[model samples]
Target chain A: MWSWVAHRVTGMLIFVFLFAHVLDTALVRVSPEAYNTVISSYKNPIVGLGEAGLVAAVIFHAFNGVRVMLVDFWSQGPRYQRQMLWVVVGLWVVLFVPFLVRHLMHVFA
Target chain B: MSTIEAPRTQFRRSRATRSNYELWSWVFMRGSGLLLIALVFGHLLVNLVLGEGIKQVDFAFVAGKWASPFWQTWDLMMLWLAEIHGANGVRTIINDYAEKDRTRFALKTLLLASAGLILVLGTLVIFTFDPCPTGAATADVPSFCQTR
Candidate 1:
């Protein structure tokens, strides 16, 4: 139940970010300076933290999405759905921890 | 009470107007979700984890990557797939939560308009990108562009 909620929330958040991200990236076409000036702000600590949060959302969504597919497609998926949820959490932690550490280092650097 | 139609029964609605849109959308969500994992993970690793990380992402860095056909295609595919996937997800959320018909219709119209604009604009930017625009300062453009 919570996973479903998390999926919806994270998916919505990512979609919002994607809307802004594409616009920001479009600045590259305007000019290199235009793009760079906008992108430079991304290095700010606050924004960098937001980036970290975004990465966390993406990682969880990716893993949980696979779990969803399994639940829908695999014959045994219903029986193992609980186990799969744990696996999704496990994978998210394993991936997100490394990403956060590395990304924070870059952000603070 | 209305009787629940059995699976695969003929529709009361005309076949011309009705299609398995939701089923295809469901399949697309799963298919694209898997591909996006690969594409997005690689993008994150290359952009955020590899040497110098976010600091390395400048106009020059972008110019450098897009110079290669590989990254251009990679990004192009990522953009289309991710945008469509995200848009569909939002559409689903709107259907679930917005109780009023007018409110749902308004929200979806806005969503579709914005998504369409972004898709067209983003694709054009990627394809029409200039690695070195004429008259830009030497410092702002990629190093390779300086030679031209």
Candidate 2:
């Protein structure tokens, strides 16, 4: 139940970001100066933290989505749903920790 | 317990009345989810985790990437897939939450309109993009433009 909720929440958040991201990328077409001016804000510390959180949301959503697919398709999936959730968490930690470490360094640097 | 049907019962569903739109959407969600994992992870790794990370992202950086047909196709594919996937996800959410018929209809219409606009706009931007436009300060454009 919690997993489902998290999936929905994260999915919504990511979608929102995706919308804004497209707009930001579109700035490149306007002019190089316009694009660079906007993208520079992304390098600041606060937005950097937000970027970390955005990545966290994306990683969780991606891993949990695979779990949801497994539950629907795999024969033993339902039986191991709980265990699979744990696996999702484990994988998320594995991927996210490195991203956080690397990204924070760049952000703070 | 079997119950007899009333004379006016509409018991049979017409063979052609069923639509597989929802089923296809379900399949698409899973299939696209898998593809998005690869596309998005690569996007993040290249744009945010590599060399200067986000700091390296600027007009020149973008110009350099899109200058290659490979990254342009990669980003174009990513743009289309991610937008459609996101629009569908949000449509599901709107259906889940907006209980009233009018509210649901209004919200969905708005959602589709915006998503469609974004898709069209983003596509145009990608294909029509120029690394350097005449009359812009040379400093703002990619270095390659100087050779022209």
* Highest DockQ model number: 1
Candidate 2: tens digits of C-alpha lDDT, residues B29-119: 8999999999999999999988888888888888888888888888888888888888899999988889998999999899888889889
The TM-score obtained by model 2 is: 0.93
Residues B41-80, candidate 1, lDDT per residue (tens digit)? 9999999999899989988898889888899999999999
Question: What are the chain A TM-scores of the candidates, in order?
Answer: 0.97, 0.98
lDDT of 1 by residue, A26-94 (tens): 998888889999998778999999999999999999999999999999999989999999999999999
Q: What is the TM-score of chain A in candidate 1?
A: 0.97
Which sections of candidate 1 miss by over 4 Å?
Answer: B1-17
Best by lDDT: 1
The first chain of model 2 has a TM-score of 0.98
Task: Estimate the lDDT of model 2.
Answer: 0.90
